[model samples]
Target: MSNYTVKIKNSAKSDLRKIKHSYLKKSFLEIVETLKNDPYKITQSFEKLEPKYLERYSRRINHQHRVVYTVDDRNKEVLILSAWSHYD
Candidate 1:
């Protein structure tokens, strides 16, 4: 299995700051660490977005939140685009 390097964007960082719940924040971090190791692992629940999102992908964090990202296989990197909530 290939290890992937995870890179979080500024928008995603801002999103993290907005997470008021400690448990949710911790869950997101744990997911990120898992992504860093093997982004394509089925346990991450990674899914490709709709055509409107083009090459973007998403991983569910919980019932209300998701982490949006894109995989760069050539570079072996996972570019985290944003942390999205259903409310916003």
Candidate 2:
């Protein structure tokens, strides 16, 4: 089991900075760590995107917020595209 390197986009970093709640922020970071180990395991709140474009996946940070990312298996990298409230 190889670990993946997680990279956050500039837009995603902007979104993360906008997170006001402490718990949501913590959970989001935790989820990112989990992705480093395994980004393909799908649970209730963690799954691949519907269209499956670019091997993208979504992991919930909380009820409203989620982390959107794409997996690069060959390079073992996870690129975070967004980390913000989905409903917002």
Candidate 3:
């Protein structure tokens, strides 16, 4: 399989660095893999974008986590914005 190039903001990178649980770390990696496999799932969250946030992409893992990202269509990169444990 080809490698998918993903970009993330500095703040977001710092945020990801703070994750403590090993399980969540594994799940987070899985989420990135899933994004490369199915990008349309990113576009599938149009209805949920908040007023202050740009509605680019999202994914739900199990029932407790959300992975939100900003899509760079020109470069075909998924820039992860922030991850929330619940509706934050």
Candidate 4:
């Protein structure tokens, strides 16, 4: 099996394809960098996370920053579905 995997959720992909209004450009970029540096750590840390939204999930990367995603437990892959500001 592959060591890691990264995927974009269908809804997020669809949203991104139509509108790039820049909700969390920098946050999203940071997530990309984090994933590149160490996908396993993020994935490991996120294994216990539960989705806050109706259809998507999210977890914190550094301090209170969030890394929203859905993971494949079988392959231990981390699929970042979205990113949200920790305001509410």
* Top-TM-score structure, candidate number: 2
Q: Please say which candidate is ahead in lDDT: 3 or 4.
A: 3
TM-score of each: 0.79, 0.85, 0.66, 0.45
| lDDT per residue as tens, model 4, 1-88 | 3455667666556534332455555556666566644454545335434444443455454454466665566775667665543463
Stretches of candidate 2 off by over 4 Å are none
Q: Order the candidate numbers by lDDT, best to worst.
A: 2, 1, 3, 4
Flag the better candidate by lDDT, 2 or 4. Answer: 2
lDDT of 3: 0.62
Off by over 4 Å in 4: 1-3, 14-19, 40-47, 51-57, 60-65, 73-76, 84-88
Any idea what lDDT model 1 has? 0.79
Which digits, one per residue and each the tens of the lDDT, describe model 3 over residues 3-35? 346766776665476443435776677777876
Candidate closest to the true structure, highest lDDT: 2
Q: How would you order the candidates by TM-score, starting with the best? A: 2, 1, 3, 4
For every candidate in turn, the CA RMSD to the true structure comes to 2.6, 2.0, 3.7, 5.9
Worst 10 residues of 3 by lDDT: 39-48
Per-residue alpha-carbon lDDT of candidate 1 for residues 1-88, written as tens digits (9 for 90 to 100): 5389889888777787776445687778878887888776776467878884478877888888898888888998999888868587
Better of 3 and 4 by TM-score: 3
Better TM-score candidate (2, 3): 2
